[model samples]
Target: MSGQRSDTECRGTHEWVSAAPFRSHLADLVGTTGLPWRAVALYADVPTRCVRSLLFGRRGRVVRRIPARVAERLLRVRAAQLNGLTARSGDAWAAHDLASRLAGRGQSAAEIALLARATRDEAALWLVGPPGWVSARSVLLLQAACHAAGMDWAGPADPWEPSPAEAAA
Candidate 1:
């Protein structure tokens, strides 16, 4: 057996799963999550000008390195949407459903790479869950995949409910 442990065997016991996204992904995220640009700017505490520039590629070109603070705020906002009992909660369950549906259809992570235009490792992460954050681009791609495969993306329609730990606190 490989020395490395699989994500499955180590579920619910890992730490600091990276949620970092590209600045371009941030732009796509606005559309996927249906959050307004102004709201993202306000919530992320980033200037509207920067948000526009990064997202629209307007006023010249895209910024290579997003400011750390801005990236942090962006991540925090996305993370909060999925916030659950644990830090990495919300999207993990949604991802579980996607994986199951895909599996039932005899699809593989390689297919996810093609469907989502994500790298192999990225596709694997989606299948396994606990991604840093799910990009809007990924959401669109995964939805498209579900449509093409004639499968409904099986996820709850409601907002994330509080975890038991949270409810008890």
Candidate 2:
């Protein structure tokens, strides 16, 4: 009677990792680098609010389910190498790096954009959310993904303005 119920039995509950580590990591990434907000936004496919949460270390809601396979595919590198690819080749590498970082941390679409190397507007577009927007949950997920990926990234500028060469691309 104690071990088994007449109709159903109680299962163990599971608690996932807290959002704090993730947020902190994101904040550090943002604070230390000069990566473009738009780039990060586009890469992560998240909104500004979620990005802000990660940057500011605020707690936001998060989606329970994660599309792990899709996330992994997005993070993985496809081709072996390119002959004359520059460091800023259409921001693809940057995006891929961001994706890898986010995938590692278990971040959602919103969180991805928020912490990417793009603008808030770009992030919102990627997330398909409104402009200048984000959520606490998205931030947490992004942080998680970055942590998972072991992305020790550092940007070159503050506010992430594109170089003249990159802008031309």
Candidate 3:
């Protein structure tokens, strides 16, 4: 299942196009932005493997043809569009803290996900785990909500901060 293409990826009703141009665009996008394929896919709202397969191929097999939707989507992608986004989801810890605070304030994970423009699963994962790859958009969205709610996300929360007495000790 790891190497398999999903039904949507394989069952595109649109005409398939030569993967060369899309491949070029993908390379350029990655190169210019220094963003990995996964980041670009997050911005594009497509599967990470879709970009990976087109850019690097799968299991030693090069993708000669690409689905029209994927091609068009990749073609329209620009490096400028990836601003504030990242591949590693650097703000996961912050997002996790925000979700926890919001949850404590009677906000559900689904509502928090909505505020972050992320899925509930993502919110739940952030809540349960320490920190993982969370998209920057989620952080930005949650940050905006926090700002509106008079909260700050300048850094790790107070509990995590080293106290002066602790430092002296």
Top-scoring candidate (lDDT): 3
Candidate 2 runs further than 4 Å off:
1-16, 36-38, 57-86, 91-169
- Score each candidate by Cα lDDT: 0.51, 0.38, 0.67
- The TM-score of candidate 2 is 0.26
lDDT of 3 by residue, 48-119 (tens): 556778888878989898667667667777887676564436577778887887877788889988887778
What TM-score, over all chains together, does every model reach? 0.35, 0.26, 0.48
Greater TM-score among 1 and 2 belongs to 1
Q: Give the true-structure RMSD of model 2.
A: 18.9
Q: Where does the lowest 10-residue lDDT sum fall in candidate 2?
A: 77-86
Q: Distance from true position, residue 73, model 3, in Å?
A: 1.3
Instruction: Please give me the total number of clashing residue pairs in predicted model 3.
Output: 0
For 115-149, candidate 1 gives per-residue lDDT tens digits of 65557776788767657765544554455456446
TM-score of model 3 relative to the true fold?
0.48
Residue 109 accuracy (lDDT) in model 1: 81
